[model samples]
Target: MSCLPVCTQRMKELAKERELEHGKRIEWNDWVADNLVVQFEKLVFPRRSQLPRASAVPHWEYSCQRLNHAFVRDEYSQLTLIPSVRENELVLQFHDFETMGQKSDGEIIFLDDITQAQALPSQDSVLHLLPAADEPQSAGYFCRFAIRDRSNANAACITPLNSGLLSRQDRWKRPRYAPSKPIVIDLSPRDLGLAEGFSQAEFDIIAGLGFDSEQDMSWRTRYPTATIYDESPPSVLSHMRRGKLLPPQDVKAGVPKVLIFSETGPLVIGGGEDPYFDLPLLNIINELNASEDDFDFLVSIQPAGILHPQCLPSFAKAVLELLKKRNSVHVFSVRLPDHGISNSQTYIVLLASPICSDVPWPATHLDTKSIEEQICHLKSKNPRADDTHPTAGKHVFLNPAGQVNVYNHGTGQLPDATDRPYFKTVDFESNIILPTLYSDHGWLHPTRHDILTVRECARIQGFPDDYIFYGADKALRSQIIASFPPPIARGIAEAIRKIIKEHTAPGLDASTFAALNLGGRPQKRTRVD
Candidate 1:
């Protein structure tokens, strides 16, 4: 076992940390050659084939540390490039060095032809290396080499090809085609060498991988596909959605809205005023740490078809000032397109908080009615698609008045008075509050509960105890707190800050920064003639 002469002290330390089997050491080039042999065989033969004899490819032990030091110390000029090697158009790079199990980077160099070497047959030939766990060292080496006499090439300068500099005819087919969508491969937990009952979340963390810049881009472009060990196709789709590689189809942007809390009731500002009537909400912007210049995005909270030219300028100015002062704020408008909900009134005074769900009900307040019986009763009454669903009535409470639960309606939009309220238990274990049903219209806890108190809703939304939601009625206060949860707001603000920092980072080109803002795609406009 010959070890390369460089970084001797560090190599010894690494060997101690990552104990080598039997203290066996192998040179970097030998590892590369072994991998190339395995990959080349895979291309020529079927998977699960018996191991073939190693190829006669010449594996020269080159020191990556020495080469990098040569470049750093300006000794590259002393080495001469032979014309024959240049004619062959071979590539040589200091692939990397490893001591024990740790890897250290080496220099990259391009090579061409050399004398007394077997010229590769016209470059369409292939080598496909997939690293195996058994021989960890013989993995990730992606270059093909030609065998030559040791005396023919200089010992001081070794040439290895960069992984991707293939001949025009030698490119791998289907690198892009295969990964167009995520792939699902079935494997049992036992097959993956896992104990019984390994949870899905644990599996995901174990399967996740990180790659370097070059390799990362390569995999992203060539293999955008995700491999799911589970057999379920929906699971694969769900994973991809989480990765943001697949945009969610049902992501409706929340409308810009403003609610003013008062002792009388919660009022939707701007009944007689201009569309930007809630511009006064900008006062809250002073609480943020950022200056006015930091704000770059805006949402207009206008009621439909109610533009006020006279108030427009002032509203715009207020918004600009708010942007300069706050980290992030979103505006939701009262008018929603295709929402089927009414927006006729500019201001709303909710009489009291509606008890849309059973979340606030104590065990003593819950009815003795079995959840199954309630679901069956609800299904019998309202057979409409908007009424019953597979999971809707299960584990969910129903109003004896046959109200529609928000989950059952499935509209991703605000509800109106016509909709009756149905209640469901919050997934308290997961910290997720189910959407509020139209409880103001007589939705009740099985025990006939009323809407949650202003403080209760605030707590569920992750608001601190001190934060208050004061308004006209319990219903109105609940609406204000429920519409915008504190946790959701915090997540959005953090994401915005990160994006802003990336955009404002020094040395980022305009096109790249713009691409980041637009999500790395050319922005297209809807043509309206």
Candidate 2:
């Protein structure tokens, strides 16, 4: 009989003793000799049926005194137990039966002398005893048994007393460590340019303009060659798609681009015998020179009507001519009525200039129309516009009691006394007026019933009180005042100046400088004598 069962029981008793008193000295050698013995007659041998007759079975003996170094033999194999006693531990080294007279690879059990705690050898010691299972025969040993040491106490014993190996879950839950690699990023020249050129406010606005929907992603995937300007106004996108107009994103910084804000009626489409495109262009260039001398030019054209599709060719031709002369030009259409002007008519503004290329073109065709639509939409939401007030109009009268009475038109009813102020009538007024003080449907003075004076109109349009109108006719003066608001012009000018300042300032990289000076034009430096 093998002594494994008795040795395991004695290990539990020694563990209890160690827990009770750590100073107790254990007689490990004596204990091993008394309890650790293997009887060959009573031990169950493997492959008993394959062994020779009972007489051919090799005889073996075991004594309690010599158990420290003993062997149990059978017909096929022998098991040798070699015990070594140290101050802290008792090592029981087992030899495999396969190799005769040689120390075949086997498990080494470490038993704590005080606690009799059983554990396998360390991983390093195990690897020293058994080589990696690269061969099919060696692989079987790994699959059948699990070798572990004190580092992992949950491992199964190799002895027949506990034949169970570690479960699959236990092996999977084992911790593993691996080396990590570094991360890297590469930025292009254009990316660097954008990074340096864009301020926080501009970056925020650009970020807001980016679309990240599945539909947008799918559209991008479908048209891999499309650019950011592909979905812009049809007029601009058509020119861009045909390689006539440069995509806004491709516009270079530092170089001045012509900005043209022109009305469609006078330049190309409206029934004008002689188009005054060059006059407006020259006027804007002069204005930019007077206001911002450092910049090349900013031209704003205010036309009387919306730009129709049929007029696009003429407009494109005009733009191409400007581009040929200026190298870059951005066009925009501005509507005066959308900007709090008393007039109700929409004016087309065309802006073409050599400003900062970093700034995107403002006022797409839809954007211009959408502003008017939104204003009109808000007006339509007024309560007085409802069908219930079919006779509603801006007609006010003073009753004998000094209260304001409103007269309902087309209702055949007398004026009714109302608590609502007279100014509220303006809220329901939807008359579209031209840029003239004497127009029948034009703005009325807030306190008086007379039309707004030319000076008042100019003030409403962001002009200073002292600003003089050179035109002799009131209508002509009104037209001048209504063309473009001074505040908006100042804002656009300041923005252009800011863009130029940021892009052309010193300290930028050589690549950025090359990018800004697109034509490889040599810088004009003063000759030092």
Q: Pick the candidate with the highest lDDT.
A: 2
Q: Residue 336's C-alpha lDDT in candidate 1?
A: 12
Candidate-wise lDDT, in order:
0.26, 0.31
Candidate 2 lDDT by residue in tens digits, 1-529: 8999998888778555544332211222222224222211111222212322443423374223322423333221122223333422112222231221222333322222122222233322221111112224332112212211121111111211011122332221111111111010101111111111222112111111122332133223322342433222333434433557564442333334323233322223333333433443343333333231122443444343223333433444554444433323433334445444444433433433332132333322221222223122112212354467744423222122343332211111221122111112232233233332121224443333333344444444544433434322334333543345544444445455454454344454435644554322233454333
TM-score between model 2 and native = 0.30
How big is the RMSD of model 2? 39.4
lDDT of 2 at 158: 22
True-vs-predicted CA distance for residue 301, candidate 2, Å: 1.6
